[model samples]
Target: MNIFAKTGGNMTNRRDFLTGSAGLAGILFCGCGLPRAAHAAAAAPHRLPVTVAGKHVKTIDVHSHCLFHEANALMGDEAAKLTPPINGAQQAFMTVEDRARAMDAMAVDMEILSVNPFWYGKERDLAAKIVSINNDKLAALVASKPDRFGAFASLTLQDPALAVTELETAMKKQGLGGAAIGDQVAGSEFSDPKFDPVWAKAEELGAVLFIHPEGVPELNKRWAGNGWLLNTIGNPLATTIALNHLIFQGTLDKFPNLKVLAAHGGGYLASYAPRDDHACFVAPSACDPNIKLKKQPTEYLNQLHFDALVFTPEALRHLVAQVGASQIMLGSDCPYPWELHPVDAIMATDSLSDAQKHAILGGNAAKLFGLKGVG
Candidate 1:
């Protein structure tokens, strides 16, 4: 059924769904002899009902983003380098009714928004201000539409103590769900002992830490060719290095209970994670003699969570096989075209059972974030 059939097939937006689409269809035919109704039907905005196997699903995208002008104000001269997004950046602006319409178009019932860590390299006082504005603004946005949206707090990871306090305040004071952090703080690996306090606080608070990657700046020379290799290769590689350090250097062991969600399907690590298990055996020098890990490197993935933005059905299926269905949740780098049809990708995977599909669509995120009263 055309959802707008009651309106003579003229209704095109949420406004029509709310009140009604009043216009009647035209009888005129095009040069091809097709009725005007055919064009209208074809041009109607796309919507994927958040449902599976005849049951309504509450689809939550664990990976989405937003930006703030207030934070941009803090950038001063650095703001000059910013460019309008060629992809769908308007989604980041997120006015309530407009965002709701956008979410409907994407089949997303809720979006857990994060700010990319552009401020991570800043000094403490400045970084703190930027993060504070972003977190406060994000809280206000969520308050306006609590059911339709959730958010991961921005943190000043450059300063661990401040980051801990920001995480604490965002979760407890402002009612944020968790914190979104970069894969590394400046050039420092997360496994550096200085970050332990922040990770420990997250573990204690049961806050999910969403690790989104900033592009690999160190590879600028080698990635000079086309295809935006900086992001396509660097972002995932950055995540891979971060997770690898966490695994090999014992951060995961130390913070076993931390609910860490990695964007880009845990990057490339989850795709062939068994290679991580063998790295120590293949090269003795890389393994730390004094600090022995309790489990093989790959087993740590069981404790981590990942977004289902791996692109192809085969990739999604393989990611699940590697990490288990429970670990996978929907992730669309929305307002961006990374994975435009996130729900369709889940629906298209023949390898996943309906129950698994249900979990991946929203159940896992709802469970992880302690979301309530969702369909």
Candidate 2:
């Protein structure tokens, strides 16, 4: 018998049991007066974790993508025209049951879902509507399966003021974990002071800002080829530029406590950080005195978080070495087949200890997302 049925009842669907008269709060907090067998069954093992210090370490994936069909439809045909076919392809349309199967195969207990930014080029009113639809759908998904999913609310960052209000609503009323933003807002870099208010609000709420690449448009001509460099090379390069601006422009220094998670293992920044640290020292004249920071450019990396989607054990090891283990989290960039074996990648790394592996797998993300029952 299933959990609800074992409690002297006969509810087969977990979603129904969660949303029924019993309510989610009662079911989650053991307020439904379930017997020991029911409680044990309800807390069934969702994942097999690596033991450390006699404790099982649950895995949480901080980088995963989901698309809401209704939200995509609301954007109109023009939105569809702009979106790449890969986005609406079969893997992208996976149902919750399908996703659960994938997660089980990956040994992932929980996933933080965020939609890649698509409406950045849309008009203000239309963009706002898209944001609403996306957030509403995301909120519903999280509410329905609180244990399996968490979310980073979508925002129309093209308008910072509206974005701030939406962020507040998503966090306060919708109970989302944070917001996901693109590498840049249209042509404006994230370092522009116009976005400071949004950054400030994120810091105030302790909401993590996930930076996912939207691809660099300026390099279209150069990136055209059979190799798909537009994605493999251009994506990370765009993220690198976005993050460098934040460092050079003093955005990170201003919002020192802001929680930022860079997708694709912080792009190319972690691998090439030392170059930035030495740039100023090598050429004092090129480094403007006014923009001088309290610490080296690479030093700011420790203040942020990165996902382990670098695709190689060596690269993952280098990222961890550059930024401490606590600053990295497991991310598969799922539904795209990027980092096909994220768990195995970490496991194969000879440089990391068992404890550090536990942290990168889920402990760090749990603390960052404020998720409970982890570590």
In terms of TM-score, the best-performing candidate is 1
The reply for model 1, stretches above 4 Å from the true place, is: 1-49, 82-85, 88-94
Candidate 2 minimal-lDDT segment of 10 residues:
26-35
Per-candidate TM equals 0.85, 0.85
Residue-wise C-alpha lDDT for candidate 1, range 64-132, written one tens digit per residue? 776666566678987744433334343234344555666777678899988888887778899888787
Q: Write the per-residue lDDT of candidate 2 for residues 173-240, one digit (tens) a residue.
A: 77689999999988999999999999999999999999999889999999887878888899899989
Q: Cα lDDT of all candidates, in order?
A: 0.77, 0.77
On the 0 to 100 scale, the lDDT of residue 375 in model 2 is 70
Model 2 TM-score? 0.85
